[model samples]
Target: MVRTIRHRTMTTNSSKTPSSHATRQQNSNKLSRTKKACFGLMTTVLGLVAIELTLALLGVGRSNADGDPMMGFSKQVPLLERYVDEDGKAWMRTAENKLVWFNDQRFPLTKPANTQRIFCLGGSTTFGRPYDDNTSFAGWLREWLPHVDASSRYEVFNAGGVSYASYRVAAVMEELANHEPDLFIVYTGQNEFLERRTYADFFEQTKAQLWLTGLVSQTRTYAAIDSILRKNAPQESDADSIVLAAEVDERLNHTVGPSDYVRDDEWSDKVREHFKFNIRRMIHIARSANAKILFVVPASNEKDCSPFKPDSEDGSFETGQRSFDAGDFASARAAFQLAIDRDICPLRAPSNFAQFIRDLPESDDVRVLDFESELRNVCIDEHGHDILGEEYFLDHVHPTIDAHRQLSRWLISEMREAGWMAADSIALNELSAETVEGVDQSILGRIDRTAQGIAMRNLAKVMHWAGRFEVAAPRARDAIELLDGDAESQFILADCLRWTGQIDEAVVEFEKGVSAYPTYFRGVQRYGLLLLELGDNDAAREMFSIATLGWPETDPRHWAARFQLSIAHLGACDFESAHRELQECREHTPGDMDVVFAIAEASVGIGEPEKAIELYEQVLDEFPNDVDTHLNLAHTLLSTKQTDRAAGHFATALSLAPDNERAQAGMMVIDQLKQSAE
Candidate 1:
């Protein structure tokens, strides 16, 4: 019995050991599973928190899912259009499409029968802002000029539009060429420099933007990838837009690289060339369309108001300086000094710009009037703050109503000097009428007689210059009757007859004018130009030579005479003589593109394509955005068998000015060639 108990205890002990081992293994597995589950839950919760934090930091939650800002405000707004009233008969829209109407009836276009109609073309100042129509320069002109005769009346039409430059004014002239006005008055020059970019600069920027946009659009897939990367990236500061806008404005205004602050002489040359080219084109169009063109140089704010002076030692004129320098005599003197330093003297600068215009042989027909000195004198007050005073300007730039009035008065004086006035019969009737019954008749009669002669002579001269042969002839005859054998009148009569297909009669009048005023280059030059047109080459050349000898070297007519002589040589097929004349022109004026192009054409005629190519390249270098140059260069390249290079340039040219047919055709050929090569 004891042996059996021992055996049972041993068995029990063995069984308990196995069961403990199994229980220990089960507890170890359960602990491992619980640890893994806890770690996974913590990781998932942390990841969700991180995502929420990122969205909040990016401001993504405030924006729509598509990435637009939640607010409905747009960054850009459309530009407003502007318009204005023209005369009493019609309303005209401004370039920006704003509506304006004249408040006065005195400047009405509808006068009595046979009125001397004057149409004025210019920009905003000419439009007479802040002044009612009755108080405008047009109204003043109407009040000033009496009717010429019973058959004639006096009327002034203010056709000026706000912000219009010479180009737009030319367009208006073209539109009104058939109106049969006795005179077309043009007052401009200020807006030309400010309103539009030089043609070359405009085209260059246009091309660059187009090409860059095209390249960007072509790489849209890459852009999309970048957008995705940017979205996933960490958020940063948001001051980029303000900085970018400033950079853009600077680029647009300066047109030069930011690192460079010095004036770009190359760009200045391009600008000069551009203005010269466009002005020449304008003159040609005006002459061809029989419109008398007169240029008016406007006063500069700096010249009228600023008080800066250049340092004589360094030639540096600091801008934005409005304080007088020590020892300056007056504010006006200081302002004038500042203007001279900045090259803002309207008379001087416009004359310089006009000199460039006149340098072109094709621009001999246009006339330039210098009103700078007169306007300057008129603009200054006794206190030297300008006639309109400091408070009359919105800024340093634009003029107020009071300023406009001053401008008007100045313009009226110039017009009077130029001999623009009304008719005799209308003057007599107006003086005799109830409106002026109480006025002084003797003073009115004397004024009327003086005005009649001046008006008739001026009307005749304007018409003759404009190539209105039929209309001008009668006016000239009338002038000769009223002014009593005036030499200038005879010269104008001769020009009118000559242009109207009455050569012999014109020669007679020209001879009479020359006999009366032997030193008058005007008569001589007109005769010379007429002779040239009639193919009397030798006579034309002689007349031009004589005129040059009589006129001062600095005179515009002197250069004009030289140009005519050059044309005569060119017409005679004397390329050597022509070249000599052109060289003289270049010596007098460097970078004259018209002369340069003419020289290049002469070189081409002489079978010097290599020289032509060089000149053409020079032109392109100077005016890379000139469509004509690009076309010419493409032609030259094609002649030289540079097909691929020419194709690339043509493509670039077309990209800049999409309306270029030649470039488009060239591009098409290039595509075909490339495809065949592939």
Candidate 2:
């Protein structure tokens, strides 16, 4: 149906074309306006979308704000709390929740006022694990300094952490400065270049990559993309983690091939620079806090250093290389080679590093403790290997508690020489007792020394053990005067006074003992026990609490103090407090029969027969031979109206220990009660 579309073609003449151009211009203006409007609308829509997406990605939306996704993820990861081991010792965890310091207290951050506080900063070596806290170098220093100067009242605080590098140590120093410490002692360097990648590397690998990307993402789509990528990325299997760790250890040991650039002079220079930088930062922080600083180049076993072969013409590198052949020679060789290349030769490196450190301007105020020299002399054998037979070290690097004691003695000597301590203090004399004991008695006897104090103190100890208070008192007093206010001497003196009806004087002496060395919990606990004996239950409980809280949780004395506090609570008729103390004591020493019995007694006092019965059963099952347990169980059963059971337990107790007065009394009562019932 082609109705032929007739098209009218307009032909413009040259004069008429101008008028046609004007009409076309109007149409073009209209098109331009429409395009501008479209562009404006698109730009506005995109801007709003961007704002919304940014809010979403940042988790700023109301729904996301209400629900913490990051917190949820964190919850899925286990949080490691401080835990006590089977041996009633505590283990420390890192900020990352990784187990670090085993069977030791986490380093404290605070220092007391008006006291000269020395903060020992280092790795596990300084932390002094597998040793009693009192035997740690810090503890040793505290114990020995008094020998150098009996009146020296310096408080040494060990702030060491496991796997801590120099940078971490510096951070710890900064954190600790808030506690107003007077001196900062640094014992680090081995871990500086030995631990897998430095803090700088960790920051680069994690913060720069994941943290920055997370910060910059705008849209949920981009955020999801990043998350998915992170999730899908290959997870490190346990075996892989272990292998990687081994590889890291190899790298730290300097096992890299010569072809690798790590062994170059530049690498050494960089390591030196890293150490210097950290040291400088540490100095700055200490200076800012008006604290004195000392740098200790860590000492290592002879095996840690290149073997000292006088005749074997071996370069340091060659000597290290030889160590590689001792074990799986290939692995050992790799380890030795890497160690040399990285300057990880523990013995040699400390000396070299010390020299470098000494040259620094900051070192003007910083004393070098010469730990390397001391350790080398003590730990090295004739064959240029570590003497592991002594049990003074746990491994090639870490010192045992006994070793820490030795180091502490050396440190005290150095400190005395440096004029950091007093010369005439009682502590110095007491600490020197051991050294003097090693001295020839003939040489000591040549001096016109009065034997009054020494003889009296010894006699008092013997008499006290024999329960002869009348004889011990005068001797203890003379000894206290001779010992010149030594805490142990004062404690003995107080015990004597307490036994001789001089209660007021005894309390004063006990207080003096505690005042002399607040860190000495034995004295404090004794004072508390004395208070309990004096019928000051409230005061005794307070003292016991203070003593227990003063030391680390793993300290045996800390548990003992808690047990004492429970006894105080019992004396004061505070059953709830007694129960709480018993619970804490039980937690620390689960197998302790005394603690179990105490808990049962506390439960009975609190009218919890069921709990008491359970605790009694536990004591009987585990400590069937314990007379006290049997006696307590009898009383608990009698209270619960189980007379027959009480009588049977009493009979067993009599069989185990026939002279047990409490058990006999309990049996008599049970028999009488049963007779009355019959």
Question: How far off is residue 635 in model 1, in Å?
Answer: 68
lDDT of all predictions, in order shown? 0.54, 0.61
Best by TM-score: 2
Task: Evaluate model 2: give its lDDT.
Answer: 0.61
lDDT by residue for model 1 over 208-304, one digit each (tens)?
6745644443333434454687589665424321111100122213532112223444544554554444454455445555544545555444432
lDDT of 2 by residue, 393-450 (tens): 4433566555676676666665555555554543344544556554324223433224
Best by lDDT: 2
TM-score of each: 0.33, 0.36
